[model samples]
Target: MALVGPLLAVVVLTAAPAGVKAGELPWPKWLVAGVVAAAGVLVAVWTPLVKARTDALAARTTREAEREAQAEAALGRLPTLKRKALLVRDMNDRALLGIHEAIPLPTDSDSDNTLSAELPTYVPRDIDADLRAALEARSRTGGFVLLVGPAASGKTRCAYEAIRAVLPHWRLLMPPDGATLNEMVAGDADLKHSVVWLNETQNFLAGEDCLKASMVRRLLADTTKPVILIGTIWPTFYDQLRIRVTTADEESEGGHAFDKDARGILELARRFSLGKWSDQEWDRAKEMQSVDPRIRQASLHRGQTGLTQILSAAPELVHRWEQAETPFGQAAITAAVAARRCNHPENMPIAIIEALAKEFLTDFQRATAKEDWLTDALMWACRPVHHSGGIAPLQAYGKNMGQIDGYRVSDILVDHKSKSAPIPDGQIAPDIWETLAESATPQACLLIGMGAYSAGVLGVARSAWERAANTGNAEAMAPLGVLLHNEGDAEGARTWWQQGADAGNTGAMTALGAMLHDEGDVEGARTWFIRASNAGNANAMTNLAGVLYHQGDTEGARTWWQQAADEGDADGTAALANFLYDQGDTEGARTRWQQAADEGNTQAMANLGVLLANKGDIEGARTFYTRASNAGNANAMTSLGMLLSREGDAEGARALWQQAADEGNTQAMTLLGIALDREGDAEGARALWQQAADEGNTYAMTVLGVALDREGDTEGARALWQQAADEGNDMAAQALRGFIEVEE
Candidate 1:
């Protein structure tokens, strides 16, 4: 098109020359020059336009090809797209499926057995309504829905059915591990209207290459590309991940830092907890017995066991363990159960299990055991009880990882055994504890100790910690010392603390210093506190400040308190607030107290209430006092009681005072005594006053002395007054002077 104008100009010039003399002008020179320049302009404008159109066509074609490739890759990444019902049936084959597969029913040769192979009909759970609502919300805006429950409680099945009902056609992208999940999320895969299937969510949220909270947040934030992240987790893992890290825990040597990303991701989830099947759900299952033989068999055990558990072959697994033919196999299974009961890790090392098995065998069985007893035990324990899908009592894992191969006891069996008796605590043999302590890894021992401590199995905790501490686990030492101190073995606690401090554990140093300070070794406490504070322990800095303040180093105390408070220590912040209040910085004190109280410091809440009350903000004071009192702050209770009494709510005041007094608050006891006296319970008031006075409450002593003087026990009153005055009680001193003058 650009050449057309130029070619036409040439033709016109040639024709003009033919009609006229050669080299003679056909028109004025200006007209000729203008015509040629116009053709040049057309050529210059049209050439780039043509090139641009060609380039655009090529780019469009390339984009189409890339889109095609991406579509194929996305399809490859998500191979599990099918009808919702078919997907539900297919999920039965998944080993890590949170819902256990049902045990098959027996079929006779001539029976109408068309439904023999099918899974039991899905009985709707009580939590299904809420689960479905969350899944439905995912379609409008992306969401993460997590179902937490015990093993085989059907959490996964509920989530699966909910998604099936809501987003049935959305492609399911089931990543094999956390790394793959992270990559799939981070990649440029078109995840719109897709379901990210995470069956055992802990596998994705924990360990290396775990899915990050930020990634999930980014995914959900994009409304244009909504994707449903649905997963199931055990209650234990959910609790473990979502645990808040306390200030003390953060500063402790053995304490764990919160798994922030895991917790954050969990927090974003619309969580549903599934419990045992309700009687209604079981009745629903019974109504469907005619449809599936498996449901019929499971229904027979409705009153005896959980219908879900029965459907999931929990009984069959238990039978397999209890009715093993070989003694060696039974012993091995029993040992594994015992280990699990003792809070041992799920992945029990093969060697540890084999060694522990011998203890379970009778003397005759042990003596008659074959050379290949372990081999036989492994085969028996690892063999699947059902023809398909159902798990064994013990399943061997970690085949490829050298030195990490072990057996995982079925959680169903563990739960079943636990229901029969208290686990890992009550009546557990000492030998089992000894064996576990001796055979388990230091990390495993630490975990066992924690579990035992939480369960109040102090003996087990002591044993586990002793083993862990013996293995040079510095983090174990401080906790061991604490356990010892709690058990009244102060000398033993000191020894372990010394060992931990020697290993450079700042928590242990702080703990030892606090203990020494309590025991009147001020210089020794000071030395350890200085070491820990220098090592960047905020708790130590706060404790050191308290010691310094007591030792008359006021400025030094202030400096250390400031440093600790700057590091976000709630105790230090509260202490600094107190110091500022003493220094007449009321506003500064209030600011620090507010900061500390916001951090969940109960004492700070109580103190802040006091400050507010002093400023005549009674309502504001009551709000804080109520908050602190509900958190079990006895001092707050006392203050709140006083406010209520002034407001003429004597009943409310008495309630609070009695509760505080029961918690051994001396001020509460004294105040309650006064209230009792006003109520005409003079004997009760005197009894309370005597108790408070015995606790060294000077006010209680003076009040009780006045009561005794009224009762004509002048000597008793005089003695109480003299004792209170010796403790620098000004009111008691004046009363004693008056009593002495009257006696003269």
Candidate 2:
């Protein structure tokens, strides 16, 4: 509309003759000139305005095109499938492929065809309803659902069916690794109503960029866009993640510092267990046998093996490896099996297996072996016996880029070996240990050492740790020292600890300081403790506080304790509470103790109970005491028993005292003995007192001495009283003086 006025003015100006002038045409010359000038001004102003609009429109179109291209690229990069577009058959093909790497069944048909090519008819288990319900709830309120079981127990299959049944329209996002999954969650990708499929969940909970508790919290945080994280894991991995690592655990040789984030993440999961098929499930499988040939074949061994195990060809895989036709092939498989047993389970390098295989071969076999023996052996190990699936005794991984990275022994074969019997300690070949020590990564060596240590195989543990320590692994040093200390090699332990401490290993420094303190070198202990504390070791800070407290530096001790507590050390928090309680800060002590108790500190719970009881809050005291006692705190048990006794619940008190005594609580033993004596069971009382006194209980000594004196055994009573008094038991000292006066 703006251009129309300019166009009309140009047309009018062109129509007028230039020579005739404006005056000869319509009106006066001045008016004509004014009209021409007006037309010129309008044309000049409108040209640039139209050009600007044209440029803007073209730029906008270009930007829209670029944005669309970017959206396409992002969609291509995403490891997700839209549920509405996803075909169930494709999902079955990918998700259930190699669900359990079992031995392939021998067949005359094509090797690429196997039972796993098409999933067998589903026989619903008892857990199905509950699992479905959980999945359904996840759709509304986002959550993590973990299915835990052994290998080939149908965990993956069951979880797959449940998702299909309850959340068929939800999108599925399967990240290739933990890092990628973390990226997806942390990125601006739309995760609404997405099912995060994590098969073999341990892989997703490991490594530097693994899925963490904080990431999970973020993933499930917004209720408006719910996400369902469904995963399958072996029971062992789940147990490892669930077990809390304590200070004692951090100090022990076999103890591993579990990933706190991984532990926390598992705690958020709604877990369900899937075990072997029961009689009812088996009956259901029987009814489906006519529909599926695989089911019919698996039903024959229903009692002997799991139905899922049969379908996955677990038994056949075990048999194939055990009865290998070639000696070299058998040796290679055996080496792989041994490597897995020693904790080198995943991505085992081919070079290591090749080196270890020779040790397993017989003298005759080694001498007669061909130049291409290794090549032939590996081929035999990896050959598929099944008609159509990639089923082999030893499955190769990392082959996508042409270079084979490593091979993993079929899980069923490893599972079978584990269930049969563990290879006795020291029975693992020396050559196997030597090869692993020389070739295994430092981290792998540490794991191998821990496994060996837990199995009471000290020699292997020592070898493994030595290898790792030689590689300058500071983490391995303190544990090596712990191994030596446990073996009564104090000098060796001190030597390793000194080396480790010099290497700036905080654990080693803390451990060395503890040893020095135990040997009566308080100043030396304090020095190392300070160094470790300065290095940001929380345990060291707690130890430093204790040293300062013993040195009568109460203010200094409190400072270190506060620092440790701030670092989230539960022991430090509990210790700080104790300090506050001693300083008569009742409210502060109660607050700190409550914090520690909530963090799973049993001692804090017992101490809190005592404080409540002193304040005449008996019911509150009982609650804390019961909580602590149920968590296996013997001290809490004894205290609760005393509380019960005061409340006139004699039977309950005696039962709690007996439980505490059984757990080696000497105070409980002494108290129970007195009760037994009152109940007219003199012999039981004497036995209890003797046991407690043997364990160095001074009160038990005094009681036992009085009982002996009453029975006319003056000499025995005198000996007991003298022993207890020498140990600084004041009651025993007074009892002895009175006894002497009576004798005189």
Candidate 3:
């Protein structure tokens, strides 16, 4: 109707003359004029706004197209970086890669140049047959193999070598941690033909909630994939797990839970034990005439010989160095013995050893010529290829003596069978300990006590300590306190420690603090630790850090640990190193461990060896483990054995493991048993297994049970299985179930 009004007006205007149309229009003339004016105004106002909006939309589209093109062009030029970044995270990128590409290896010596070549030519020894048998057997029953060894042992190398031989073109996968392992197993569909190796496998099995262990168990139980898993575990850790499994209190609420996990892990895999390189293996290695000539020369050096041979060569070296009848060689021997009596042989500062040598010179009234005595010779013997920050300041300040290598001193004629070596007077110059004790000097008397104590002459040690204590010597008082503490006289220990502490003996103060800490007196311990720390005691600093950590002062604890480590305390370095490792600073952790190990920290040696192995630094790891094992560290011995085995030195590995086993290392005993069985000594193997089982090794018990069954002694097997099953051994339980079925 509105359109009609406008149209009628227009038609009327057009139909009639302009003047007559307005007067004759159907609508009023003014209204028709107003409508037409409004319509013209609306068109004029809206036209510019619509055109501006259209122009903006077109510009935005052009900008977006330009940005897309630029992004595509930039991405095209970054393919290399993009590929590497993506490959780092890609599952496919993990397969068939070399160890060098995955982790950094050591290049300490010329021998490292041939490390890659050595891996391929590496001969396998003890576990070779067993592994081969497992490979064949797994084809039918479908199971994986776990090669167990010590830190420096060649478990990982041997596994890779075997893989290279068996699965030439197959991909090798190494997942760094538990989370990555889980992701790979769960997400990787083409895992069937690939080889996965978890080296230093103990990291996964440790702690209460072992997610890695559980994951491994599940993977083993999964029969769908023919995936081969080769795991290398530290023997000590495996032994610890076995103990937890076999000694579980069945009636306890949580025992079953612990046993179930441990037992399931034990039953899921077949075990092969490896040891250190044997003499024959070493001979064979030399025959390979490695690609590196320097390595061959090093092998020929007297220092590069076996521990026993090196020690035996030492006496000859001394004889050659000191042609005269001077007593300097004997003085060095006495000092070396005293040095080994400290917390560890490496813990004795070079200054102290040098000081002890000076005492011998002064007593002998010899010329004080720096060249006459053994100080230079001793220093040379103690020099390390690597310098360490973890050496005590006194040892490094004036003399700048690197960490002591001990020249394999501990390997010398110590009475291992009887554990009672002759006194210094008998072994070195006559009356050395007696003269020092009779001197009545506090420091001299303390040295006399230490020497006597090391020789198992406790009575002499006590007499020397008492003489010095009677003279009110605080240093002597502290040693007396240590004696009482070792003898289980806690109250006596505290009284002596108190007296020594009052006399300003920092050692006594630390000892008191340790006793108080053990007695649950946290505040008292803190007070003493602070006093000792102020007196410049590295051990006290370490202790203070521990207490602070327990009190929830993590930053304070870290500060104390850093202070201790800076002062060359091995415990401090180890703690700090472990903290860094847990925080994923592997390089930092490695540095600290190396420092601590250089200072004669055996635990640090084992840990450092593990780190080096993970990084593919086999030779470096072996050296640390060897040093630690020579220092009487059982874990190091175990690890070194594995390395030796990897190098096809079965006898060397066995010797190391036997020593460790004698020191009550159950894992060593278990491995020794396997070696015995392999060598056709079934009865010996059974006896060793029995001994281990008696010490609460569930794995040994299970193995023994299987052996008995195989020997047709069903009743004996049933008895063993029943006992093991009651302890929550899954394999034992399964065996019992099968036995019941057969009977029915």
Candidate 4:
């Protein structure tokens, strides 16, 4: 009956649809309940999926924040060489087979090549005789010797002569480069008593070779053994090496080269210069060449004039090779030219040469394999280089422009005037500046600007810097600000630095902090200093520590200083040592000072000398003071003089004081005057005393006053004595009172 009623209602609605509207048709309540239950099921299924996605997004955001925090922490820490130890150690694992392949063993006619039993005849120069004696003396104690000279200056011959005289029974072991040398030392027990000679030693001493520094450290460490390490260097290469000079005098005096890497080498080695052959030596060399076959073969071109000719032929030979029709020669010449232009010598990696060949000599003949092409290139470069083995081994290569596999050309051929040492008042040519401004990249302009700055060409530097700064490159920011500051635009400098700081430049932040500190806005300086320090500026870390210490946060300051020292900052090490000394940790301070001194921190060297002297280690103190004084530390000169005087070497003390006075040290002037007075040089003593007195030295004033009184210059004596007494000089007071009594 229900089916029949529903059917009847549907039929009625369908029949009335054309003209009739009907009210709600109600049949059953069960249909409506079923629809509502289905909708609830759909809602239930979607809820968990949405919640899962939300949870995943939240977890991802948390992980990103944690990663950002870790990144910041890593950025805050300073770069250290600690990580390089493992890398340097691993470099020693390279096989030794390829290293010594460059320089073949000496060969005789149709016989196997071997070191000669007969002593190599050498035309004995003063330096050669000294080297020979020194080598013989240190043969049993594993001392280092550096033979530095110009190209073809017979340095290698000197090495051979020295080794033959010193270690006649010992085998000659010449590993190709620093890495192989280190490997040989580590793996071969026989090297303990052997003569290890490294020729063209600049290859090893370049800063990119960490293994070389490591090798020097190891050689210096075990000096008790009978191993002798000798190396020959080009004079130009030696000049290019980093020297840690702390004072203006040191720079002016052409400072001693003992950077972080070179320090160990310098400490262990006694340096000897092989001068160009004198006219007498050259004549003697001709006579020796007739008697000695070794000398005859080594000196094929004869003396210094012939050697210079051979060296000058390098670029000409390269040009000739380039002008040749053959692709191999052209490719070789191109690579050599590229290397020369880049200022890298003989340190070109094979792979880099090949890459360059591929780029520059794409259509070259394929008559030889790619390897032969590189060999040909080196073979051509070596043609004009006398006394050099025909080909450089792969190990001779070093980073070019900091690229691992790049190649360097022979430096002898390159026109060096363009890269000459900057003259203090040098001016860049108008054409040079125009070319640089017109064609150079932004980065290149910045480098040009730096060069100008170094050469004291301020106008050119400003122009270049302005050009670079307009590009909005971040590196130019702080340097431009520095130029502005130097030009007396303090507010402009601050504005530029602030802008750079806002752009996240740590250098600019440091510059701002330094300026503020100089201006006595210490609180503002601290804020900028902290920001730069947290961004991993080593200078800023030291600056922050200084400000913190000034503000009485001693512990916090100590923490920052320790952080800086751990990062291997020389200044930071010195500062930390001072802090430790203040805190009564003398031993700790000594350890830190030693570390800093070894790194060539001039202040640390002077400080270490003082500390060692206090500890009754006079010899150690003398060593440090001599090193610091050589680096032009006036304080060290004065201290060293005092020590020499204490040891009864008055002449030596006086000489050091004279040197210090020449460097504008008032204390040295006063002391030297006293020494001169004792030596009965009354006029010289008076002049020095007068100069020192003018510089506000109380002792000098009193001494000068007494000398003037003795010389009958009563008015001058009275004035000098009165001024000195006013400055709290007891001697001056006594002298002044004596003059007053005499006047009465």
Best by TM-score: 2
Off by over 4 Å in 3: 1-461, 484-494, 502-504, 513-535, 543-557, 680-683, 686-744
The positional error of residue 664 in candidate 2, measured at the CA in angstroms, is 7.2
lDDT of 3 at 391: 14
Q: Please state the error at residue 426 of candidate 1 in Å.
A: 8.4
Q: What is the C-alpha lDDT of each candidate?
A: 0.68, 0.68, 0.53, 0.55
List runs of model 1 lying over 4 Å from the truth. Answer: 1-148, 154-272, 278-312, 355-371, 399-404, 418-431, 438-443, 520-538, 544-633, 636-662, 675-691, 708-744
Candidate 2 RMSD computed on C-alpha atoms after optimal superposition onto the true structure: 28.8
lDDT of 1 by residue, 368-473 (tens): 8889999889888888887765468888777675644889888776655443332322345777777777788877787677556645567877888888899887
Candidate 4 or 1, higher lDDT: 1
Question: Candidate 2 at 197: error in angstroms?
Answer: 6.5
> Per-prediction TM-score, please?
0.60, 0.62, 0.37, 0.47
Query: What TM-score would candidate 3 get against the native?
Result: 0.37
lDDT of candidate 2? 0.68
Per-residue lDDT tens digits for candidate 3, residues 1-744, read: 111111111000000001111111122221121100000000000111234335545765775565455434433332233353222123222123222111112245545454543222344455676687676566433456788764335566566666655655544555544445544443333445546656656444432123233345445545566667767765645664543221111111111122233334554577887765576666655765565442344356533433222212333333322332344544454454444332122234444455555555554345655564555545444442124211111122223466442232322222111223323322434344444455434544554565566455666677777886777877667767767666777787789889888888776787787777667776676677777765556667666766665455656666767877765565677767765665577799789878767655676787677667656788888887877778787767766776676677879888987998898766567567766776778898888879977887665676677667768999988898788778756556777787888799
Worst 10 residues of 1 by lDDT: 37-46
